[model samples]
Target: MAHFVPRASFSLPGSIPKTYFLGHHHSGANAIKGILNTINLVIECRDVRLPLSTQNPKLESLVAGRQRLIVYTKSDLCTDSPAATHTLRGLYGADNVLFWDKHRPGTTGALLRKLKNSARAIDALTGLRIIVVGMPNVGKSTLLNALRSAASPEKKAKAAKTGDQAGVTRKVGTSVRIVDSEEKGGVSGGIYLLDTPGIFQPYVEDGETMIKVALAHGIKKGLIADEILVDYLLYRMNHWNPGLYSRYCEPTNDVNEFLTAVAKRDGKLKAGGAANWQEAAARVLSLWRIGKFGRYVLDDLSDEAIRAHQHLLVNPHLSQNQAKKLQREERRRARTGD
Candidate 1:
């Protein structure tokens, strides 16, 4: 865990490379600017498992003062209970926050109904132009397709590209009309969805956050070595859900030895009967990524951590100890409702 910490926090020193952005500025600028120009509503999508880490606060600043809605995608992959909804609402704010599982067929209708109900102020003649933004592999494209599917049953082709891997939607700010007046058989039916590439902050300030983003597949793979990611995942699984992991393999803190054991058990082998540790590492990561280890929240969204993060964001020059004090005071105020 200690050895992997540096890779996770590399962004803290402004060392994040171009590969992370992957030409989002050049290719996706049109969509972002278009959103700025024509967007009536901003739908910010996030992975349910890592709501806080995957959020791009910088994007929020860009679209500040707009009618923004936070929709947590990939809800099916999360293991959180019903109460988790309330937790998210409390952290993000009360209205216009929603949970969605794209795999569910009726999700689009439900989302549209929610949107219509929320946007009562907007006249029926006015169409809804929404831009979906999030980190990579958080299902922005899938959500768009779902909306397209629900809006027009005759449209069979997918409106946006989608895949299990990150960076599939390299070109940002592409517009796809989801519903038109013809489909609704009236003059009042126009809904458009703008798709944007996954945009990440220039620097990620924390190691644990980077790890969580990687685990969520928000960042492109191979940016962080598989071994380092697997190591962190193993540590987290052991700490958080040891019983589920122990069912597959014996508990061990050593990443290398654990990978070897997993390789041997799964029959992943090199030429000379040695365990294929790399393959084993990949397998372990895949299971956790797909929710085999159960649901887990990567961000420590406790009031104390939230205040610490807020304080750090606002007072970047503050020392670590000073930030801690600020966090404590905020927690006290929250407890007293002050």
Candidate 2:
């Protein structure tokens, strides 16, 4: 087993990759920039499973100056507790963040009220144009579809295509009317939504965050080795609850051994009856992705991690150089003594 590393120990990248900013004329960060001046409210969608890591610092940096509301999406897939929600509210600011599950009835109504209240200060004379932004596969498109469906039964057509994979929305699609004053029953407003391509900052200095993001399907598949991901999942499950994988294999901490046993039991064998452990590892990860094991919030935001994250969030007075230096030193200290 690898040595335990606290979530607070890893360093975050200062900026994202330039490629994320480039692409189709109407897509990427450019789309948001073009309409930045016009957008009244920004709805920042994040995976409920890894709220902190998948918030995308690069995207946050751009919209930092705007009137923004953080929407924690995919609540249906997460097993977050009330205490966890309280902790998140404290971390991201209670008034600015909200939870959402598209599958639940009346969820869109709650979100609409919150949006209207949050953007109450903005003068949306031309109607409120709310832009939905987030990393890939966090259901940006799916949320837009839900909103459209709830707004009007006649407007049941899908505005954006959605899939279990990432990067499905390659370009910026035309804006759709999400709410109207004539909608009668729901929240009254002239609300429009634009869906943008999934973009990320260039580098991620931490290993655990990357792994959690991948496990949550925020990052595209095949970018990381399957076995490595499976190994990390095994470690996380063991740490969270011992013998979590006992139903699939014998109780043990050896990831490889457990995978081998699983392969043999499932009759996944290569030539000559050798166990196809790689296939078994991929299957394990697939199950985790679909929440077959159980709902999980992957980022371990313990008290220590929360304190450090809060410090980073509230310390805006620190100079850019000073902030980078502090992050570097924190990572060094976390690694050196451990």
Best by lDDT: 1
Q: How close is candidate 1 to the true structure, as a TM-score?
A: 0.82
Count of backbone clashes, every candidate in sequence: 1, 4
Residue 143, model 2, lDDT:
85
The C-alpha local distance difference test score for the whole of candidate 1 amounts to 0.70
Candidate 2 Cα misplacement greater than 4 A, ranges: 1-27, 80-82, 116-125, 183-189, 310-338
What lDDT score belongs to each candidate, Candidate 1 first? 0.70, 0.69
Q: How well is each residue in 95-199 modelled by candidate 1, as lDDT tens digits?
A: 778888877876677887765554444645556677888778889899988988786778999988898877788776466777665345522446678888877
Any residue pairs clashing in model 2, and if so which? Answer: 16-201, 16-202, 17-201, 17-202
